[model samples]
Target: MAHKAEDRTYDVIVVGGGPSGFVAAIAAAREGARTLLVERYGFLGGMPTSAALGPISPFYFDDEQVIQGIPHEFVQRMVADGGSTGHIRCTNPHGSGSYLCFYDREAYKWAALSMILEAGVTPLFHSFVSGVRVEGDRVTGVSVTNKSGTSFYSASVVVDATGDGDVATLAGAEYVVGREADGAVQPSTMMFDMAGVDTAAVKAYMDDNLDDFEWASEMVAVHPYSERLPRQHFVGQGFKRLVKEGMDAGELHLGRDSVLFLTTCHPGVLHFNSTRIQNVDGTSAESLTAGEIEGRRQVMSLSRYLIARFPGFENAQLIATGVQIGIRESRHILGEYTLTADDVMSGRKQEDVVARGYFPVDIHNVDGVEGYGEGGVWAGLDDSYDIPYRCLVPARLDGLVIAGRAISASHEAHGSFRTQGGVMAIGQASGTAAALAALGGVAPRRLDVAELQAALLRQKASLRRDPERAREERRRAVQAVSAALAEGRISAKYLADAGTFTGQAPRL
Candidate 1:
């Protein structure tokens, strides 16, 4: 095949069309950049669309909802299309607070694609960014492969949103893989949906069985799991509690015609992310392959369990599986600043901050103990800390900006930053900053801090300052709750949800 040279240059070329890349392309184009988005898959919305993920996880910033910029618009569109419930659940992550929203994956994908088209971004699907072309200290373009073989696309700025930092590492950016010393990384889960579930029957079943913790414990103990991450028996019951509260408050109606039914949706659809693959290095292709294989097997088991044990699900079937490997760990590109776990716990603000991660440090480990059985614990700083612009700037790499889960941060901090909601936040800021840097004819690191902050604000990003004050406020709240827990002033369950746990002992 003969490769032909094209005489076109884009103002911005974004690699990896996941949550981060999709938002990056929209942000850049909205800022008046001629953007081209390249995705490895056939369509957009990396994990959510391709992998069939449900909802936007870890989406709130304290009581104030933080995911309100470009991503919010995409979500709203999905809700309006009758594709999602748009239910925002506020969870206390080990006493730390977080928000999650349930969304229809296909609806969200279409919404993202619509945004890109509306913003005039040229999306090249089924294209993989294989290599980066560098000239002097600046990245001139990227090498990509498609059905047409290898080709080059030149751009003034490149945003790497491939959750694994594929483009960044290929561009010679230094990065860290997995955890140091402890050899722990968040466990990966393959989410699957079940259908033919009767919502009312499912709710009734949970109400009757959630208190049967002993029975669940015995069953899970015998379950063939390679890792022993504490499985919470009360998660189903907890949701039942929430439902009761909603019904009492008149916020949720559970009747047959009610669209807000708990388990039943469209007559037969249920989603599960129960396949847990631990110690799987997300960056290594071999490990990822193994995880995928195991994920499929786990989903098959879950399908059997649902059919045998649960009501409504007896007729339910596993209709779909995630499109890509649900990777929970990957490379962390070293930047000018390494965000520490302490920063996240204290909600430390920074003068040079470009974005804030309000989600807790949800550290998921293979040997991690179980207490509540939901997700991981949030031991990070109170409130949220700023993600310094430097974290996105790959160390010693010019004109290359790393976005999404690959940004420089401690392993603990990565949990807070790796959520889909958090990725969209960082992606918007990084994309706009990259476009501005390209226009200014300077490397992303060399761009003026004030200018970058101004650009971020213009794009409606909630980048904060004054870390010390935020830290003090959060510290006071945490201390007050810790004292209450110590004196048995509050229920342990409540403390766990509010993120107020203060012991080496597990909460369960």
Candidate 2:
């Protein structure tokens, strides 16, 4: 059932369709490139869709929303459709002003498809990039294979949005994998959602037994699940005591100290990101296969523990499981700039900055343990750090720019920039840069930063949202929410999402 090579050419060809790729193709086409987006699966939304990573993180930094442009618009649209929990702040003091938004992954797939089409980007699904035809350091063409056969696609520029940096690697782009100490990446996760639970009961237990729960920070009040009501959401926190009991009794097999869960658009349903399957490198086919099987077993075991022991889940129902195993870290290319941990920790502002990230340096323990030891994690700041334009340009590789979790950053820095919101911004930048490069027939390295910045601003991209002004905005919003609460017009959960503005944190 195989056919001969069919040739096609475009101004830009982007590989992957997850968080970054979804917007990268759209951004490229909007910039007037004849763009094509290729995906291994039938649907888009990448990791969030296939791997079920929910609650997009840190689109905001304290009071200011840092990531803008097409990516912000996409989330705003999802909000209007009741598919998102918009801008819920993490109250933990140790947290990095992380903005959390729980979303419906199923709805996101359709939203991504619609946006890609509306932006005039062509999408090819159920296809994998099987080969790359490179001329020296530049990739001239890519070969993709599907059920029909092999097909070749030529593009003036290529964007590597693959979370693992796979395409760039094949194009002779040098990449580093895992942490510097050991050749091991972060652990993989397989997520699931549960239904038919008394979330109220769960909340009551948590609020009453604050001593029983282990928090990301002691600064965070034991606001229960119901505390996340009206705006109505939950996330990877709650009930460490129950998890410990399960582990001690041999009811649970995972090593994670805290539970990872989130809310959906659906009431009485919650997403769980608890299972940790370590030692799986996502780039390997065999590894992914084994990871999937192991992840599923963990899912079943964890599901059983929830129903049997957890307070909120006395009548819990296992609803759905992720289609693919979620890989946290993988191959990252050496770019013009290798973003360092010191750069991130010092809150370094770059002259040629492209995007800003406010998420914490959250490294899930590579050994599948609960917490970090000596060098595992760094909760550096609650402020924003800019990602430089140089980090997108792969060194010694022409016609290529990297996006998503695979962008050039140290293991610690990558933890922050790898957040979905950060990658989305990087994706938009990648697309715009690629389009400009293709139009002028120049390599990405030679493109002017000023022109790119102007283009991004015109598209409503946010390079900065002044902390003072943003803080004032937060004050006004929170005052309004406080007024509503004073009048007994809004519920506590509803107020939590709006007026409780922990406004613009000081610059680190």
Best by TM-score: 2
Model 1 scores a TM of: 0.79
Name model 1 segments beyond 4 Å from true. 1-4, 91-98, 212-267, 368-376, 465-508
For model 2, what is the error of residue 34's alpha carbon versus the real structure, in angstroms, after optimal superposition? 0.3
Least accurate stretch of 10 residues (summed lDDT) in model 1?
214-223
In model 2, what are the clashing residue pairs, if there are any?
18-46, 236-261
What digit string (tens of lDDT, one per residue) describes model 1 on residues 1-508? Answer: 3434653478889998888888888988988888889998878888777766754654555434556578777767766776654433222333323334555666677888888999999888888889889887677789989998888899888998898888888877777876776757777767677777654576455546545321110001111121222211112322344434444665543311111112212444656644567777877779888888887776676566557655666777788787866777778888888888878878888888877787766665455323233445545456767788888888887878888988998788887777887889889988887888888788888889898778777776767634564455344445544555566544344323444347533232
Estimate the TM-score of every prediction.
0.79, 0.90
Would you give me the overall lDDT of model 2?
0.77
